[model samples]
Target: MSSAPTPSRSVIHGDALEWLAAHPGTPGASLLTSLPDKAELGLPIERWRPFFQQAASLCLQAVDEEGLCVFFQTDNREQGRWVSKAGLVLAAAAELGVPLLWHKIVLRRPAGSRSMGRPGYSHLLAFSARATVPAEASSPDVLPELGELPWSHGMGLAAAEESLRTIRRASPSTRLLLAPFCGHGTALEVANRHGLDALGIERNRKRAERARGDR
Candidate 1:
Protein backbone atom coordinates (compact mmCIF):
# COMPACT_ATOMS: atom_id res chain seq x y z
CA MET A 1 0.00 0.00 0.00
CA SER A 2 1.17 3.51 -0.79
CA SER A 3 1.25 6.25 1.80
CA ALA A 4 -0.83 9.39 1.33
CA PRO A 5 0.91 12.57 0.27
CA THR A 6 1.25 15.35 2.80
CA PRO A 7 -0.75 18.50 2.17
CA SER A 8 0.96 21.87 1.55
CA ARG A 9 0.79 24.63 4.15
CA SER A 10 1.92 28.27 4.15
CA VAL A 11 1.74 30.96 6.78
CA ILE A 12 2.33 34.58 5.82
CA HIS A 13 2.81 37.46 8.23
CA GLY A 14 0.96 40.43 6.74
CA ASP A 15 -2.26 42.40 6.74
CA ALA A 16 -5.23 40.22 5.85
CA LEU A 17 -7.24 43.06 4.36
CA GLU A 18 -4.43 44.09 2.02
CA TRP A 19 -3.98 40.45 0.96
CA LEU A 20 -7.71 39.99 0.30
CA ALA A 21 -7.84 43.24 -1.66
CA ALA A 22 -4.84 42.28 -3.76
CA HIS A 23 -6.16 38.81 -4.49
CA PRO A 24 -9.87 39.03 -5.03
CA GLY A 25 -11.87 35.99 -6.16
CA THR A 26 -9.15 33.46 -5.53
CA PRO A 27 -9.70 30.32 -7.58
CA GLY A 28 -10.12 26.84 -6.08
CA ALA A 29 -10.00 28.32 -2.59
CA SER A 30 -12.39 28.63 0.34
CA LEU A 31 -11.94 30.75 3.47
CA LEU A 32 -12.12 29.92 7.18
CA THR A 33 -11.48 32.81 9.53
CA SER A 34 -12.54 34.81 12.54
CA LEU A 35 -12.60 38.58 12.28
CA PRO A 36 -11.00 40.50 15.12
CA ASP A 37 -13.29 41.85 17.80
CA LYS A 38 -13.21 45.29 19.43
CA ALA A 39 -10.95 44.03 22.20
CA GLU A 40 -8.38 42.67 19.77
CA LEU A 41 -8.47 45.70 17.46
CA GLY A 42 -8.31 48.23 20.34
CA LEU A 43 -11.18 50.06 18.71
CA PRO A 44 -14.46 51.23 20.21
CA ILE A 45 -17.62 49.39 19.25
CA GLU A 46 -18.60 52.23 16.91
CA ARG A 47 -15.39 51.91 14.90
CA TRP A 48 -15.12 48.16 15.12
CA ARG A 49 -18.58 47.55 13.71
CA PRO A 50 -17.76 49.06 10.34
CA PHE A 51 -14.34 47.51 10.30
CA PHE A 52 -15.81 44.08 10.99
CA GLN A 53 -18.31 44.46 8.19
CA GLN A 54 -15.60 45.57 5.76
CA ALA A 55 -13.38 42.67 6.68
CA ALA A 56 -16.27 40.25 6.25
CA SER A 57 -17.03 41.77 2.84
CA LEU A 58 -13.42 41.42 1.76
CA CYS A 59 -13.32 37.79 2.83
CA LEU A 60 -16.51 37.07 0.93
CA GLN A 61 -15.09 38.76 -2.15
CA ALA A 62 -11.88 36.79 -1.96
CA VAL A 63 -13.62 33.41 -2.02
CA ASP A 64 -14.08 31.62 -5.33
CA GLU A 65 -17.59 31.66 -6.78
CA GLU A 66 -18.16 28.00 -6.02
CA GLY A 67 -16.19 28.00 -2.77
CA LEU A 68 -17.44 28.65 0.73
CA CYS A 69 -16.35 31.32 3.19
CA VAL A 70 -16.85 30.09 6.76
CA PHE A 71 -16.71 32.37 9.77
CA PHE A 72 -16.47 31.26 13.40
CA GLN A 73 -17.60 34.14 15.58
CA THR A 74 -18.35 34.49 19.26
CA ASP A 75 -20.78 37.12 20.43
CA ASN A 76 -19.75 39.54 23.13
CA ARG A 77 -21.45 42.14 25.28
CA GLU A 78 -20.63 45.83 25.03
CA GLN A 79 -22.07 48.53 27.31
CA GLY A 80 -24.53 46.00 28.74
CA ARG A 81 -25.90 45.21 25.29
CA TRP A 82 -25.19 42.12 23.22
CA VAL A 83 -23.44 42.39 19.87
CA SER A 84 -24.06 39.79 17.21
CA LYS A 85 -21.03 39.12 15.04
CA ALA A 86 -22.98 36.63 12.97
CA GLY A 87 -25.52 39.33 12.15
CA LEU A 88 -22.70 41.55 10.96
CA VAL A 89 -21.47 38.79 8.69
CA LEU A 90 -24.97 38.37 7.31
CA ALA A 91 -25.14 42.07 6.51
CA ALA A 92 -21.88 41.90 4.60
CA ALA A 93 -22.99 38.83 2.70
CA ALA A 94 -26.28 40.47 1.77
CA GLU A 95 -24.43 43.49 0.44
CA LEU A 96 -22.45 41.23 -1.88
CA GLY A 97 -25.53 39.14 -2.82
CA VAL A 98 -23.90 36.09 -1.25
CA PRO A 99 -26.36 33.64 0.19
CA LEU A 100 -25.91 31.97 3.56
CA LEU A 101 -25.31 28.25 3.19
CA TRP A 102 -25.60 27.22 6.83
CA HIS A 103 -25.45 28.61 10.34
CA LYS A 104 -24.44 26.24 13.15
CA ILE A 105 -24.00 26.94 16.82
CA VAL A 106 -21.00 25.59 18.68
CA LEU A 107 -21.25 25.54 22.43
CA ARG A 108 -18.43 27.13 24.37
CA ARG A 109 -20.05 26.06 27.60
CA PRO A 110 -22.66 23.48 28.43
CA ALA A 111 -26.28 24.46 27.99
CA GLY A 112 -27.91 26.32 30.89
CA SER A 113 -24.56 27.78 31.86
CA ARG A 114 -24.18 31.50 32.51
CA SER A 115 -21.35 33.77 31.46
CA MET A 116 -20.73 37.41 32.10
CA GLY A 117 -18.50 38.23 29.16
CA ARG A 118 -18.63 36.19 25.93
CA PRO A 119 -21.66 34.06 25.21
CA GLY A 120 -21.65 30.36 25.99
CA TYR A 121 -22.08 29.52 22.33
CA SER A 122 -20.32 30.66 19.20
CA HIS A 123 -21.67 30.99 15.67
CA LEU A 124 -20.42 28.95 12.74
CA LEU A 125 -21.70 30.40 9.50
CA ALA A 126 -20.93 29.64 5.86
CA PHE A 127 -21.62 31.79 2.79
CA SER A 128 -21.27 31.27 -0.95
CA ALA A 129 -22.13 33.38 -3.96
CA ARG A 130 -22.95 30.56 -6.36
CA ALA A 131 -22.94 27.31 -4.46
CA THR A 132 -26.01 25.75 -2.86
CA VAL A 133 -26.11 23.15 -0.09
CA PRO A 134 -28.21 20.13 -0.84
CA ALA A 135 -30.84 18.89 1.60
CA GLU A 136 -29.06 15.58 2.00
CA ALA A 137 -25.86 17.31 3.06
CA SER A 138 -27.37 18.85 6.18
CA SER A 139 -25.57 18.46 9.49
CA PRO A 140 -26.58 19.28 13.03
CA ASP A 141 -27.35 22.92 13.69
CA VAL A 142 -26.01 22.75 17.21
CA LEU A 143 -22.78 21.16 18.41
CA PRO A 144 -22.94 20.26 22.10
CA GLU A 145 -19.44 21.39 22.96
CA LEU A 146 -16.16 22.68 21.58
CA GLY A 147 -13.60 19.89 21.67
CA GLU A 148 -10.38 21.73 22.54
CA LEU A 149 -8.63 25.07 22.15
CA PRO A 150 -4.98 25.62 21.28
CA TRP A 151 -5.25 29.19 22.57
CA SER A 152 -7.83 31.37 24.24
CA HIS A 153 -8.75 32.91 20.89
CA GLY A 154 -8.24 29.87 18.73
CA MET A 155 -11.10 28.12 17.00
CA GLY A 156 -11.98 24.89 18.77
CA LEU A 157 -10.63 21.70 17.21
CA ALA A 158 -14.09 20.12 16.88
CA ALA A 159 -15.55 23.23 15.29
CA ALA A 160 -12.70 23.48 12.82
CA GLU A 161 -13.13 19.85 11.81
CA GLU A 162 -16.87 20.28 11.32
CA SER A 163 -16.36 23.40 9.20
CA LEU A 164 -13.90 21.59 6.93
CA ARG A 165 -16.17 18.60 6.63
CA THR A 166 -19.03 20.85 5.58
CA ILE A 167 -16.86 22.47 2.96
CA ARG A 168 -15.66 19.14 1.61
CA ARG A 169 -19.19 17.89 1.29
CA ALA A 170 -20.62 21.06 -0.17
CA SER A 171 -17.75 21.97 -2.47
CA PRO A 172 -15.68 18.93 -3.34
CA SER A 173 -13.63 20.90 -5.86
CA THR A 174 -12.21 23.17 -3.15
CA ARG A 175 -8.52 22.36 -2.77
CA LEU A 176 -7.16 25.23 -0.71
CA LEU A 177 -8.20 26.62 2.66
CA LEU A 178 -7.39 30.31 3.10
CA ALA A 179 -7.39 31.71 6.62
CA PRO A 180 -7.00 35.44 7.28
CA PHE A 181 -6.33 36.76 10.77
CA CYS A 182 -5.28 33.17 11.42
CA GLY A 183 -4.00 33.80 14.94
CA HIS A 184 -1.99 30.66 15.87
CA GLY A 185 -3.22 28.70 12.80
CA THR A 186 -5.72 26.33 14.42
CA ALA A 187 -7.69 26.19 11.18
CA LEU A 188 -4.57 25.81 9.05
CA GLU A 189 -3.33 22.84 11.02
CA VAL A 190 -6.76 21.23 10.95
CA ALA A 191 -7.07 21.77 7.21
CA ASN A 192 -3.71 20.25 6.42
CA ARG A 193 -4.37 17.29 8.71
CA HIS A 194 -7.52 16.56 6.73
CA GLY A 195 -5.68 16.50 3.38
CA LEU A 196 -6.33 20.04 2.18
CA ASP A 197 -3.73 22.63 1.25
CA ALA A 198 -3.66 25.51 3.75
CA LEU A 199 -2.64 29.15 3.49
CA GLY A 200 -2.84 31.57 6.40
CA ILE A 201 -2.13 35.28 6.87
CA GLU A 202 -1.63 36.90 10.26
CA ARG A 203 -0.36 40.34 11.13
CA ASN A 204 1.26 39.17 14.37
CA ARG A 205 4.74 37.91 13.51
CA LYS A 206 5.00 35.58 16.50
CA ARG A 207 1.58 34.11 15.85
CA ALA A 208 2.46 33.69 12.19
CA GLU A 209 5.58 31.80 13.11
CA ARG A 210 3.60 29.58 15.46
CA ALA A 211 1.02 29.03 12.74
CA ARG A 212 3.81 27.73 10.53
CA GLY A 213 4.89 25.37 13.35
CA ASP A 214 8.31 27.03 13.39
CA ARG A 215 10.84 26.00 16.00
Candidate 2:
Protein backbone atom coordinates (compact mmCIF):
# COMPACT_ATOMS: atom_id res chain seq x y z
CA MET A 1 0.00 0.00 0.00
CA SER A 2 1.41 3.32 -1.02
CA SER A 3 1.19 6.15 1.45
CA ALA A 4 -0.24 9.51 0.47
CA PRO A 5 2.34 12.20 0.01
CA THR A 6 2.11 14.86 2.67
CA PRO A 7 1.10 18.20 1.27
CA SER A 8 3.47 20.93 2.32
CA ARG A 9 2.18 22.76 5.37
CA SER A 10 0.37 25.59 3.62
CA VAL A 11 -0.91 26.97 6.86
CA ILE A 12 -4.33 28.42 6.07
CA HIS A 13 -5.13 30.16 9.32
CA GLY A 14 -8.62 31.60 9.76
CA ASP A 15 -9.02 34.22 12.45
CA ALA A 16 -6.05 32.49 14.05
CA LEU A 17 -3.08 34.58 12.95
CA GLU A 18 -2.20 35.07 16.61
CA TRP A 19 -1.15 31.40 16.75
CA LEU A 20 0.02 30.97 13.16
CA ALA A 21 3.19 33.05 13.46
CA ALA A 22 5.09 30.06 14.82
CA HIS A 23 4.27 27.98 11.78
CA PRO A 24 6.71 28.28 8.86
CA GLY A 25 5.87 29.78 5.44
CA THR A 26 2.32 30.75 6.34
CA PRO A 27 1.08 33.60 4.15
CA GLY A 28 -1.39 36.24 5.33
CA ALA A 29 -4.65 37.53 3.87
CA SER A 30 -5.94 41.08 3.84
CA LEU A 31 -9.54 41.81 4.86
CA LEU A 32 -9.78 45.52 4.21
CA THR A 33 -10.58 46.47 0.63
CA SER A 34 -10.54 50.25 0.49
CA LEU A 35 -11.61 53.34 2.35
CA PRO A 36 -15.12 54.58 1.79
CA ASP A 37 -15.40 57.40 -0.70
CA LYS A 38 -14.43 60.68 0.96
CA ALA A 39 -13.42 58.66 4.00
CA GLU A 40 -10.86 60.22 6.30
CA LEU A 41 -8.83 59.11 9.29
CA GLY A 42 -10.08 59.69 12.89
CA LEU A 43 -12.82 57.58 14.46
CA PRO A 44 -12.84 55.48 11.32
CA ILE A 45 -9.16 54.97 11.91
CA GLU A 46 -10.01 53.31 15.22
CA ARG A 47 -11.72 50.52 13.32
CA TRP A 48 -8.62 50.00 11.19
CA ARG A 49 -6.51 49.50 14.31
CA PRO A 50 -7.67 45.94 14.63
CA PHE A 51 -6.15 45.24 11.22
CA PHE A 52 -2.81 46.58 12.37
CA GLN A 53 -3.12 44.88 15.75
CA GLN A 54 -3.63 41.51 14.15
CA ALA A 55 -0.76 42.04 11.74
CA ALA A 56 1.59 43.37 14.44
CA SER A 57 0.71 40.63 16.87
CA LEU A 58 1.35 37.95 14.31
CA CYS A 59 4.58 39.51 13.06
CA LEU A 60 5.98 40.02 16.55
CA GLN A 61 5.00 36.54 17.60
CA ALA A 62 6.59 35.15 14.46
CA VAL A 63 9.81 36.95 15.35
CA ASP A 64 9.92 35.42 18.84
CA GLU A 65 9.47 31.96 17.36
CA GLU A 66 12.07 32.57 14.66
CA GLY A 67 9.36 31.79 12.14
CA LEU A 68 8.47 33.48 8.89
CA CYS A 69 5.47 35.78 8.51
CA VAL A 70 3.64 37.85 5.92
CA PHE A 71 1.24 40.78 6.21
CA PHE A 72 -1.53 41.10 3.65
CA GLN A 73 -4.04 43.94 3.65
CA THR A 74 -6.86 45.01 1.32
CA ASP A 75 -7.52 48.48 2.57
CA ASN A 76 -6.39 50.82 -0.23
CA ARG A 77 -5.86 53.76 1.97
CA GLU A 78 -2.34 55.05 1.49
CA GLN A 79 -2.71 57.74 4.12
CA GLY A 80 -2.19 57.86 7.87
CA ARG A 81 -0.11 55.07 9.38
CA TRP A 82 -1.14 52.38 6.93
CA VAL A 83 2.14 52.74 5.08
CA SER A 84 3.94 52.36 8.39
CA LYS A 85 2.24 49.05 8.99
CA ALA A 86 3.41 47.85 5.59
CA GLY A 87 6.99 48.89 6.38
CA LEU A 88 6.89 47.23 9.76
CA VAL A 89 5.34 44.06 8.43
CA LEU A 90 7.89 43.91 5.64
CA ALA A 91 10.74 44.51 8.04
CA ALA A 92 9.62 41.80 10.40
CA ALA A 93 9.14 39.33 7.54
CA ALA A 94 12.61 40.16 6.22
CA GLU A 95 14.20 39.68 9.63
CA LEU A 96 12.57 36.28 9.99
CA GLY A 97 13.08 35.35 6.34
CA VAL A 98 9.30 35.17 5.99
CA PRO A 99 7.53 36.20 2.83
CA LEU A 100 4.44 38.37 2.71
CA LEU A 101 1.69 38.41 0.12
CA TRP A 102 -0.07 41.76 -0.09
CA HIS A 103 -2.59 42.09 -2.86
CA LYS A 104 -5.98 43.71 -3.36
CA ILE A 105 -9.14 41.99 -4.54
CA VAL A 106 -10.94 44.41 -6.83
CA LEU A 107 -14.67 44.29 -7.47
CA ARG A 108 -17.05 45.98 -9.85
CA ARG A 109 -20.85 46.08 -9.62
CA PRO A 110 -22.53 47.46 -12.69
CA ALA A 111 -26.07 47.21 -11.30
CA GLY A 112 -27.08 44.36 -13.63
CA SER A 113 -23.63 42.80 -13.71
CA ARG A 114 -23.73 40.49 -10.65
CA SER A 115 -24.68 36.81 -10.80
CA MET A 116 -26.35 34.39 -8.30
CA GLY A 117 -29.29 36.77 -8.20
CA ARG A 118 -27.06 39.09 -6.23
CA PRO A 119 -25.47 42.32 -7.31
CA GLY A 120 -22.79 41.17 -9.70
CA TYR A 121 -19.49 41.84 -8.00
CA SER A 122 -16.65 40.81 -10.29
CA HIS A 123 -13.97 39.18 -8.15
CA LEU A 124 -10.34 40.18 -8.56
CA LEU A 125 -8.07 38.45 -6.03
CA ALA A 126 -4.57 39.75 -5.55
CA PHE A 127 -1.66 39.31 -3.10
CA SER A 128 2.10 38.85 -2.81
CA ALA A 129 3.90 36.08 -0.88
CA ARG A 130 7.69 36.17 -0.86
CA ALA A 131 7.89 32.45 -1.45
CA THR A 132 9.26 30.67 -4.49
CA VAL A 133 6.29 31.61 -6.64
CA PRO A 134 4.34 34.79 -6.93
CA ALA A 135 1.25 34.97 -4.72
CA GLU A 136 -0.85 36.16 -7.65
CA ALA A 137 -1.74 32.67 -8.81
CA SER A 138 -3.68 31.25 -5.86
CA SER A 139 -6.29 28.52 -5.65
CA PRO A 140 -9.53 28.48 -3.77
CA ASP A 141 -9.67 28.34 0.03
CA VAL A 142 -13.15 26.89 0.60
CA LEU A 143 -14.25 24.91 -2.42
CA PRO A 144 -16.68 26.72 -4.70
CA GLU A 145 -17.14 29.01 -1.77
CA LEU A 146 -13.60 30.29 -1.65
CA GLY A 147 -12.78 31.56 1.82
CA GLU A 148 -16.15 30.10 2.88
CA LEU A 149 -17.18 33.72 2.82
CA PRO A 150 -20.85 34.16 2.08
CA TRP A 151 -21.56 36.03 -1.11
CA SER A 152 -23.87 38.31 0.79
CA HIS A 153 -21.05 39.14 3.15
CA GLY A 154 -18.40 39.57 0.48
CA MET A 155 -17.12 43.13 0.12
CA GLY A 156 -14.85 44.99 -2.32
CA LEU A 157 -14.85 46.96 -5.56
CA ALA A 158 -16.27 43.84 -7.25
CA ALA A 159 -14.43 44.92 -10.37
CA ALA A 160 -10.72 44.68 -9.70
CA GLU A 161 -10.09 42.09 -12.36
CA GLU A 162 -7.45 44.24 -13.99
CA SER A 163 -5.54 44.65 -10.74
CA LEU A 164 -5.76 40.95 -10.01
CA ARG A 165 -4.40 40.16 -13.45
CA THR A 166 -1.45 42.35 -12.68
CA ILE A 167 -0.82 40.45 -9.48
CA ARG A 168 -1.01 37.12 -11.30
CA ARG A 169 1.50 38.30 -13.86
CA ALA A 170 3.78 39.42 -11.04
CA SER A 171 3.68 35.98 -9.41
CA PRO A 172 2.58 33.15 -11.69
CA SER A 173 3.27 30.14 -9.49
CA THR A 174 1.22 30.84 -6.35
CA ARG A 175 -1.74 28.58 -5.71
CA LEU A 176 -5.13 29.95 -4.70
CA LEU A 177 -7.27 28.15 -2.14
CA LEU A 178 -11.02 28.45 -2.51
CA ALA A 179 -14.36 27.29 -1.12
CA PRO A 180 -17.78 26.81 -2.76
CA PHE A 181 -18.94 30.33 -2.17
CA CYS A 182 -15.35 31.38 -2.80
CA GLY A 183 -15.87 34.91 -3.91
CA HIS A 184 -17.37 33.88 -7.20
CA GLY A 185 -14.54 31.34 -7.44
CA THR A 186 -12.94 33.90 -9.69
CA ALA A 187 -9.61 33.85 -7.92
CA LEU A 188 -9.42 30.08 -8.05
CA GLU A 189 -10.40 30.17 -11.66
CA VAL A 190 -7.96 32.98 -12.25
CA ALA A 191 -5.11 30.98 -10.81
CA ASN A 192 -6.17 28.02 -12.87
CA ARG A 193 -6.35 30.25 -15.89
CA HIS A 194 -2.74 31.20 -15.22
CA GLY A 195 -1.28 27.72 -14.84
CA LEU A 196 -1.32 27.75 -11.05
CA ASP A 197 -2.64 25.00 -8.78
CA ALA A 198 -5.98 26.05 -7.32
CA LEU A 199 -7.34 24.22 -4.30
CA GLY A 200 -10.74 24.32 -2.57
CA ILE A 201 -11.88 23.36 0.95
CA GLU A 202 -15.50 23.32 2.01
CA ARG A 203 -17.47 22.46 5.15
CA ASN A 204 -20.43 20.89 3.45
CA ARG A 205 -21.48 18.07 5.71
CA LYS A 206 -25.13 18.99 5.42
CA ARG A 207 -24.98 19.27 1.66
CA ALA A 208 -23.09 15.98 1.38
CA GLU A 209 -25.73 14.24 3.47
CA ARG A 210 -28.49 15.67 1.33
CA ALA A 211 -26.74 14.50 -1.80
CA ARG A 212 -26.36 10.97 -0.41
CA GLY A 213 -30.02 10.87 0.56
CA ASP A 214 -31.01 11.97 -2.92
CA ARG A 215 -28.75 9.38 -4.47
The most accurate candidate by lDDT is 1
Q: What shift in Å separates residue 139 of candidate 1 from its native position after superposition?
A: 0.8
Task: For candidate 2, report its TM-score.
Answer: 0.33
TM-score of each: 0.96, 0.33
Q: What Cα-based lDDT does every candidate model obtain? A: 0.93, 0.33
Model 1, residue 39: distance off in Å is 0.5
Clashes of 2: 44
lDDT of 1 by residue, 1-215 (tens): 99988999899899998999999998999999989989998999999999899899999999889999999999999889999999999999998899999999999988999889889999999999888888898889999878889888889999999999988988888999999999999999999987999999999999999999994
Candidate number with greatest TM-score: 1
Model 1, position 142, has a per-residue lDDT of 99
